[model samples]
Target: MDCLSLLEHVIVTLFLAVLISIYMNKGREEFFRILLLGLKSLPGMQGLISRVLKGEVTNFVKQVNLDETTKGGKRPPRVVIPKKGIPYDELREAMAKFKAAETNHVEGKIFAYTYTLFDEHFQLQKDCFKIFGEKAGYSENHDALVSLFHQAFLHENALNPMIYPSLRRFETEVVSMAAAMLNGNENATGFLTSGGTESVLMAVKTYRDRARKLFPHIKEPNIVAPITIHPVMEKAAHYFGLKVYHAPVGPDFRVDVQAMEKLITPNTILLASSAPQFCHGIVDPIDKVSELAVRRGLPLHIDACFGGFMLPWVEKLGYSVPDWDFRVPGVTSISADIHKYGYVVKGASVVMYRNEELRKHQIFTYAEWPGGLYGSPSMAGTRPGGNIAASWAAMRALGEEGYMSKAKELMEATIKLKDGIRKIPALEIIGEPCMTCFAAQSTDPEVDILAVSDVMETKGYKMEKQQKPSSLHFSILPHHVPFVEPLLQDLAKSCDEVKANKTLAKKGSAAMYGMVATIPDKAIINDFIVEFFSEVYKCN
Candidate 1:
């Protein structure tokens, strides 16, 4: 070999040797994380990465309706406070005009985040909020008079419950009711959170604090959970300075219990599982994992954010739900959202613990300040009394029968939809989903699901595209039952159309999806998504 070539080989070898030493001493995850810090410094890498990401970001922005240029329509005025307020009628007109910009989701084609069923039940919440806001309920003994307080409770602060005793009652009752539904024992206690994310954050914080008190020697604590666990858990780890070890899911899309157990090290502070994971809608093998958690003497948190309200009813309906609740001995905590299937208004959830001992870690107290011996539960202060009131009122009104009825209808609709999808020649359900939510992927190699999604969009369905095995997400609601047959027909036609040409897969954001699938480096995809978000939020 030439002298120059021989010297290059020797330098590269020595550098690799140093990297190996760092990996052995500092650990694989940290070593790679540190190495990636200087990724932009590598010759030609930054430019290539940026170029690849720019095209993908442009595609994503356009796909989400952020068109590059305005043509015919006038821009909405970005209004600050006017010197004179716009009259009430004019303000109402502006509100209606803004609202008109959205798709007619009531047609049942758009499978968005919320799946509200009834206008009547929705009115109950509106009345309750107005009862708090303007000054309204489902009390078994008497009509829950929410309007008694008027705007007084709406303006009231929940931080000092002594002054706002009714809001306190609403919050505690909502928490207690959720605990009872999840089969939490008498000693089991918890606090109300703004939503599922906050509940998860608090749960993670509580467990981390507990580990600090118990295992003070472990400075760098970590959490072990299924790869399919909600991203909120990742958010918690990021905020709380905890490392995460995500165990891979099995072919069934359930977390492999053995793989998860292997990831649990001495530094692992907690274990997490989802009742039905968000990505594929498959429940992790929590029963087996709970046994491992018990063996390891580690806290296990079941995130039932999606299935929280429905699964209890599913069990009641004899739908073969796996054991994943407080009935299990090793489950130390659970995060359940009332906002979703609970049919309440937005932003209400419960974070439960086996007992107050563990929950005490989640409580924050400040005696050093002039704030006069403050103690707050969860991460939120100045809590909304309206959310609490609506949650309480809705749960009381619905009772078990109301929820059970809705759950049954939703299950029936989901089954019908799943059956229909199975009949489609080119499409198949992604996993053995535990609940009403599921995803559909291409059974035929020629059929690109993302391409099918673009077609479905043309048919007025707001289909969410999935990765890992390209699919389209479906979250079915009770009211969606009526549109099941129509959706199935459109889906079948879309699949057939996409499969026939194959070149159609190259059109629109399907090209973006194809590019994302081929790219081996995930950091580039991360950059693409970040850029997409930046473009999406820029003043239009």
Candidate 2:
């Protein structure tokens, strides 16, 4: 009787334990679900996720070894202000050593991240930067260089225009020049920004604010943009509490205007398209989109950041380009990077609006600050005067004639490169590219484009990999002009090698890219990328 009772009790105890464990697991799952929902509602959370997933966080971590922990348990050197300063020469030597590992972009082998120029033009910019480096536009220094800098910085932080009339004047002139090139009328007004990303951000922010004022009932403002529109637009939408409705693109990689129109709703605050999108370097149908915007009574923003400086000349050279600027009646704003094709050093772009009323929305001013009245035109608070000065100097130095000549050369080189690419039967251009920037895909299944990229890398050529339809992107610059034939030869060789060794597609970046591209659950991919970022940021 005692053994039977004990066995029954043990069985009951085991059953109770199993029941409890199941309930606890359910509770944990519910808790995680609630936590994830909360995280999704938070602003910039997706941005942080996207940044981590996009390899930016990993790239940053690779560039900086911030962790001090070491395997030997030794105290690592801390980066602190030295009690005694080192000699300038010694400091320079240290800096040179630090930079020794960086890619030699000047050699023209690298593409995707850099835009190089003629050595002489670069020298001119460097000299201008050095002269204006220390002087802020706020300073009253009236020397010619300072005066030029003052002009460049004037309207940038135009809250107090009286401080530097020259800055306002130069800024106006720069804006006017950009507007004229973009075919905008006298009503066009804009301000210089830090870069293309900032310019795009400002445009998004301005349109968002305008929508808030005009359509008060709209709770969730959204932007209609091509899938190929710069990712910065998505970032801007994330930061400003706007939703981005990405419209599908056609086989040409250009946004389908009808599909984009279908995505528009009453809450649609802005319509955007790229002038030669960054991925495939094909312009969206801005004319058709502009007509749609006009019909819908909405604002259209042309993100010509990459093509702003080059496309105008391309058109002037008798190349057929679609109407993409303010000349279109419905277009309200445009952002063009002076850094990309403008031949300006890496930190200047312009966002032009149809009128002052529209531009005012981009301005941020807080008069209630304890210190004093504070305001900012674009994203940054303390704008770099040197960037403005250098940009201005570059523009003025190049002039219309210089830019035209350079554009002609770049176009010719682009033609040569495209012609060479055509000669490679396995490789095909992604779309009908309108500018020097374009992408190419491997048509033959035996040759993986990503594998070709890896092979090209081994040949000392860096190429950008594009998804959707897997391909390789190239943005030709003055430096790339000389390397056009060489790049073509390398591309052909890489394609041949990849075609010969099908297994190469399963190695290096090709393997990673191919695997990620085929993954249905992007969350898993994002998690993996976030883990990569974590590993990259690990100091030890």
Candidate 3:
């Protein structure tokens, strides 16, 4: 090899390395994440490192195991298909056994997820499911009742109105109902999504595409949102190739409107705030943020996924709820989860827009295919009909009167719970919650919030723990109404017990959460989460 050739090779290599570093540094957090992941993938290195840190790794694994067992006893059977099919009766028995191992959310033993109503209402939902089990909206050959139920399912192919006219009608009506509830005018239109995440994703995608069309010269798009905005928005930005600039919140846990506005730039395509954000159950200053959005000529998205179904009724019942929905003039879109507060079976959410023109950006169409053209309304191509049908049935069965009554009960329970927490000297509510969900942080240094959570779990109350200022979250559902007093009593006892022995924080899930919160290197936390998900998906 010649000296000149070697010199040129070195120069090119160094130049490429510099360019790669610059590209990665553009998004430093994600860049470090990818770098760590690449290093972990090196052959034999990860295992060798794990062996070297055996003691630390083993303690983390033990904590994971303890947390899993504390949540629900032993793991369920990981069964593969049998060589020959089993009888239906045997399969049913096995299924029942597996289900028996889970925490009974119906009895209010669980708290974080799984919303339910009175037994009769639940039975009605079950009956509806049974009645429509064999039906699919893809076909038109069914009885009138089944056809009516089938209307709820909107297929991706339904973009061609001729294909599934009923689907279009059902979806339109659903969006209209949601829009009216949120105080949207006649121009409002949207489509039903599988869940809240997809709804938020669609909104992000819409705004990104809108920017691409209107500001073609802009190289990168960004969204300015409150730090408390649902993590789904972050996921959306990651998936759609956009950046998120999170604005700091105030001590009240609501978005600081001034801070959010200052983050907006020419490349900012969307501004977002949550209606009672999931962490602390405090609504951001939507009205104030809307003013900024209007002035900046940017689209604003209100994420009401957690509070949408309940807030209007709460306000109707005389609670002073903030302006968070379509009623706000500058609010361009809103995402609401029907499954959460609507008391419907899972996999149902609504995403609404102020006008059809904005919704056009959400729709996708592909032509020039050999098999003809294709179009999809949301992310998924073939969505489950049962989710939509069951949601419709649940909503219809629980009419406005039923929902209002339930909301009243939930609010009353929330009041009692908040009052109870306030009574505890060691704990304090994170903020003035606008809805039934709220978090309680430890006020006394001796009372570890995570330890309190562990004790609450032992008492058979499933409590969700949060970070960034450690706290325990509660979502008071109708099922929880009966158990509110008991929960408070247990919580009080737990606080006292934890305060008595600060070392309790060194054990079980408390220790794990403490480690996660205090860890400076988030890459390790990310790896832990990835590993935990891998464990969840393992069959054996």
Say which candidate scores most in lDDT.
Answer: 1
TM-score of each: 0.73, 0.72, 0.72
For candidate 1, give the lDDT of residue 282: 82
- Report backbone clashes per prediction: 5, 4, 0
Cα lDDT computed for each candidate against the true fold = 0.79, 0.78, 0.77
Residues 501-523 of candidate 1: C-alpha lDDT, one tens digit per residue: 88889997789988988999989
Model 3 TM-score, all chains together: 0.72
Cα lDDT tens digits, model 2, 55-164, are: 77455544564323467856444222122333334433433443354445456655433344657876565455443555543232213333444333332333344333
**Model 1, C-alpha of 410: deviation from truth (Å):** 0.5
Per-residue lDDT over 1-540 for candidate 3, one digit per residue giving the tens place of the 0 to 100 score? 899999979976875585578566677666666556665767898877667787685567566432222436463232221223333344335334534644454565743323456578765664564434555432322122233343323212333433333344445555766777888877887888989999999999999998898899877899999888899999999999999999999989988889887898878999999998999899988889999999999999999999989998899899999888888888999999988897766678999999988998998889968977787889987655545654544554455776788899999999999998899999999988889999999989899999999998988878898888889889988779888878889999999999998889899888998778788999999899999999999999
Q: Candidate 1's C-alpha lDDT? A: 0.79
Off by over 4 Å in 1: 1-152
Q: Native-vs-model 3 lDDT?
A: 0.77
Model 3 worst lDDT run, 10 consecutive residues: 76-85
Better candidate by lDDT, 1 or 3: 1
